[model samples]
Target: MSIPLAERIRPKSLDEIVGQSHLMGEGKPLRRIIESGTIPNLIFYGPSGVGKTTIARFIAENANMTMYKLNGTSASVADIKQIIAETEMIGGMNGILLYLDEIQYLNKKQQQSLLEYIENGKITLISSTTENPYFYVYNAIISRSTVFEFKPVTPEQISPAIKRAFDLMAQDIGTEVMLEEGVVEHIARGCGGDVRKSINTVELCVLSAENGAKGELLVKMDTVRELTQRSNMRYDREGDEHYDILSALQKSIRGSDENAAIHYAARLIEAGDIISLCRRLLVIASEDVGLAYPMAVVITKSCVDSALQLGLPEARIPLAEAVIMLATSPKSNSAYMAMNNALEDVKNNGPLDFPRHLQNKHFDGADAKVRGQHYLYPHDYPDHWVKQQYLPDALKDRVYYEYGENKTEQAAKAYWAKVKGDKNG
Candidate 1:
């Protein structure tokens, strides 16, 4: 069996590494640390394929230290103790680096076992995680180590690496290799800033491809597409990304950007989170497209019903239509704002009694004249409409439901003003 192209081309020295210029650039903190040959107890945090594990290997190799690698998913406290004991047997744990991948998978108890080894300097622990360490890693472990964040490798930085992979493939196959124009660009973009994924994609393409008439391995765009599926869509269905995408979708609709709104809706549809999509759309209808387009809420509900009946793949159609309708509709948040403001006042002031006239007359022994004192019956008046005190005495002057600026709201606002002789009534 041959070594994977990604492993074969892995950078042994920091100089050979591509991307992560922010940390690996000249005179950068990481460069300075690695060049000094003094590795620290550190955590490398970032997205996958951005060279976190590679960097750890480079650190251990560059420092001339004996390194032990462990997967946190499989490594138990006993395994860690055994590794530490091995280091102890080899003369008191100096110059020993332990690389633990997926460190966030280790529970608090498992994490606690590392603290003693780290505290005593028996082993330099360099952990890598794809999640935000501050949220996932143990506070004690994170506090003791320096954190280096690895950013996504940009297209320009990753392009040369793709070419390097081509050369490596040619060497491995003993033939000249050729790639169609834009193939490298396409892979780089599709890999979503993951260099490892891009390299593996290239390797897969070359391995699966047949030699051309001239015996040269020619990789075409379609071949690349067939080998490499769509770009990695970074989303955690129940994590921060869930709320983030929902916020983006709602904001895009509220901002009336149809393209952006539809794009975000597609993300939710792709994730198969129909319930979240429905909930967010309903909210957008009420909170964003309120009285300005009252029918939007009804349309969104209908779409939700259609999505439920149709289910995925086909469900995306109704979601897209709802996104487009909400995105293009006139927006007003007056009703939402009114409810929120009223809620705040109610919360602060405690419960207020209902108006005397509004109280149930069906209650046994309830008086209409004395207790309901001066309550006028609107049915006896012309137009069957009357302006009477609805708000509690304390909030009589408080205006919560001010009409928004839109044609529909303006018409309603005008009628209220005419009926009550006050615009805010």
Candidate 2:
């Protein structure tokens, strides 16, 4: 059977592995661990398609240790026990190494069983997980394992890997594929540092190119554009996708599209965007719903506080309630628009001078310089009504707030009209 392109090119040695130079660099902790020849039970935590498995294989090969591999997704407790027994019976100079991939899938009991084995140090344990171990692994198992975090592949690191792949393909196809400058960087960035995805995308693009008829098999920007346009929408913990979900939620609310709002909320919940969901709702309540529905802000704040108190799964309920309530409520963006308009004026035109009479009198020269400057104390006037320059001279006629015509805002408008006697009088 022919080996697949991805596997056929898998790095057989550390030098061949792309990215993860931090761990393999001179005097790095991982390098030290490998040199020591006796490694503590370890957990390799990172996103998928980076070189976790490759690094594990390199360690096993270099150490010349008896290796046993198991997928945590499929291995049962019985299988693990049997492997443990078999490992002990193996008569050889090399010690045993157990590599468990996706170890977070193991349940509490299975994790406990493995923890016991790791504690005894009879077999060295190295587990890989795409999930955050703190949430998935039992404390006992985590305590026994030394944790190593792997970062996503950077553009500079991925450049060489792409070049290496192109060179390999060139040998077989008898033609050079000339990638445009920064094309690989763009692909690497679009892949969001996923080496496996980057390599596969390049492979597909190269294969799609014309057969040996050109001066160079050029991978154009258009190819990358088309590839990334249809690429899977992935949620990266450290990337812009995290904030993109929040932006979508806020826009949906602002646009008054309840269905879109709810859909974005669901996406955030599914993507584990709990803290972000709570925070955005809190702001929306105060800034969008505002006094029009005072209770919305109250409910949103309660949801945020409760989520912080309870934490995930259970916390998701209060979060969902806030999302639904905010979505279904009478929508308004007046407050948001008001603040933004005022902010823009401030940023572009700079701060305006406050009316001297309204300035604080606590400072040394404030009382003498700012007192009796024709200030109208509204509380001391009839119906607490007075016409005074509340805004600065530069912004006297500038309208900042445009009240929504909701029931609550209309009522507020009536009260203000009675007080000011400016109700179309």
Candidate 3:
């Protein structure tokens, strides 16, 4: 197969790169590193098509050292050893620059094989991973490398690359190629900040377009939409990026940003991971919206059930409802915090005996003193409540649940205060 347009048009120099201005911008750390001509062991971390591979290519072309490229998914120990063996021979001469892509796929042994060579400066390593390096790459590799993050290009940032690709396509066809309004922006926005994917998409649209009068290629909006229906959105359910979406969704809800919450919810929905979305929404209801709006837990449960029953497209409706409710709802973490605090004590302090009155009567042996004695049933009292020491003796004075500031929690707090006869409560 011919090389993909993304690879064909890949940036050869830092100047042609579309995004990651943070690292490649003027006087940026990476630019300075490259200009210094004394490259170090480096790790480029980010989603795909954001210039990790491009930067490595640029370095390989510019650096004086003999460059070797390997993909971690396919590169073996033998492959690494061969490179290292070669590097050792060339060590006192031109040196070696190794560009390893998807470095997270390299297990410990394969990664360790390069360590001695890298440490000795026989191999200048440039590794890239779509995963968070700390989570996936070995600690030794991380400690030895300076990490640069590549963020997705904004639509505006991607526009230039899209235009450049269109120009190239026109040249290939040996005719003028005219673009309909919004065609460039459509491709730019559709790739989810992926420059390579945008180029691929541009090639697809150009090839799919119909020839107009005078033998000119006319790219239209309809053709762009038809081909780009499934825009590139990087989502790995097991990866950190997926969890990031869940975190953003919950935080937006907790922060009461309804629009932001809806946006994240929509992203998850588009990713077609209803089960994860349902599970996270349910947790958010309890963990973030707990006690302040107690009914939120129940409502979220209902929404989750409806979503499961309805399935995607339709499922998104109930999920959107749940997300909006959570974002706009009064928020609190009082119950969640109390449970966590109590769990800490339970885990660290070890199991302790329950209060005599709270212990199960059946568990009481001839030492029945530990149960069934002086147990005052609350239902027999007015308001169906009574003050009793429910905590173990050592923890009897410890307070866990602090009432949240929401009106619902405040009212409950006031009622309990009256029942306890705490005048200052």
Candidate 4:
């Protein structure tokens, strides 16, 4: 079969590569390193279709080193050893560049095997991972290498390469290739920041294009739409994207941005990750919403139950309700904060005793060493509430549960202030 368009149009030089402006732009770290003509042991990290491999190939072409590509998924320690064994061969006369893709898959021992060759400068190990390298690649490998993250391409950044793909195809066919209005934008925006996916979309459109009356190719929006029906949502459920979405969801709710909260919830819904979605929404109700709206916990619980029973795409309704409710509701972390504060004291103080008055004991004679412990009963008082030391003696003055500023907590504060009079609230 013929080479795919994305591969056929792979960037031949640093200037041709698109996206990762933070690293690839003029005077950026990667550009400076490239200009210096020294390829260090490097780890290229981030999501797929983000040009990690393309840059590695560019380094090989420029460095004059024999590049041996080994995938961590299938390559054994023996494969690594064989590559190292080539260091003395004529192929290794200049230098050896080992491009190990999916470096996360290699066991620590397999990765350990590369340290000797790489440390001695015989093998320049350029590794790439779709997952976060910090969690996957060995720390030793990490310490010896300079890590550069390749980010997703924005539609604006990748538009030039998409135009190039069209121009290249037109040049080959010896005729003009016309793209329908919005076709480029659709392909660029829909491909989820993957350069290869965007290029492949263009190729498919061209293959399915019609011949115009002027002997030119005409690519239309309908073809682009059909080709990219499932392209927009791209993320590894096991990777950073998943956690980032979850974190964004909670933060948006905490910040009371209903629109952003709804948007992130919809993305997770599209991914069909109902479990994580429901769990995070529930946590937000308590951790973020807290006592500001006391009923949020119950309502969120009910919505989550409904979502679990109903399942998506039908479950999105209740899930959206819960998300919006938490986002728009008055927010307070008072309860969450109070629990944390109490926990800190418990941890730091070490084995604090509950006040004898608060301990569970029967009124029988054997219970209190036959002494008058006199734990006053609050029920005998006027309001069925009376001031007493609930905290241990050391923490008697340490107040933990402070009322939040929202109406709900302030009302409770007012009632307590009335009940407790001049003593406390």
Provide C-alpha RMSD values for all models, in order.
10.8, 14.8, 9.4, 9.1
* Model 4 Cα lDDT, one tens digit per residue, 1-425: 17778888988778888888899899899878867778899999976788888888878778888899999989999999899899999999879999999999999999999999999999999999877788889999999999998877888988999999998877766878999999988888887677887888777788789999988889988888988765544432332245567889999999999999999998888877787788788889999999999899999999999999998678999999999999999999999999999999999999888766666864556655446546889899877778887888798899898999999999999988888995463
Better of 2 and 3 by TM-score: 3
Better candidate number, 3 or 4, judged by lDDT: 4
Model 1, backbone clash pairs (residues 3+ apart or across chains), number: 0
User: Could you tell me the lDDT of residue 9 within candidate 2?
Assistant: 67
Candidate 4 local distance difference test against the native: 0.86
Name every residue pair that clashes in candidate 3: none
Candidate 2: regions farther than 4 A off: 12-16, 89-93, 212-216, 234-425
Per-model TM-score on C-alpha atoms = 0.63, 0.57, 0.66, 0.66
lDDT score, residue 156, model 2?
78
Model 1 C-alpha lDDT per residue in residues 113-228, reported as the tens digit of each score? 99998998889999998777898899999999999988777888899899899888888889888888999898887776778889888888888777899998888889888666
Ranking by lDDT: 4, 3, 1, 2
Give the worst 10-residue stretch by lDDT in candidate 1.
Answer: 232-241
What residue pairs clash in candidate 4, if any at all? none
C-alpha positional error of residue 96 in candidate 3 after TM-score superposition, expressed in Å? 1.6
Clashes of each: 0, 0, 0, 0
lDDT of 1: 0.84
lDDT agreement with native, every candidate: 0.84, 0.76, 0.84, 0.86
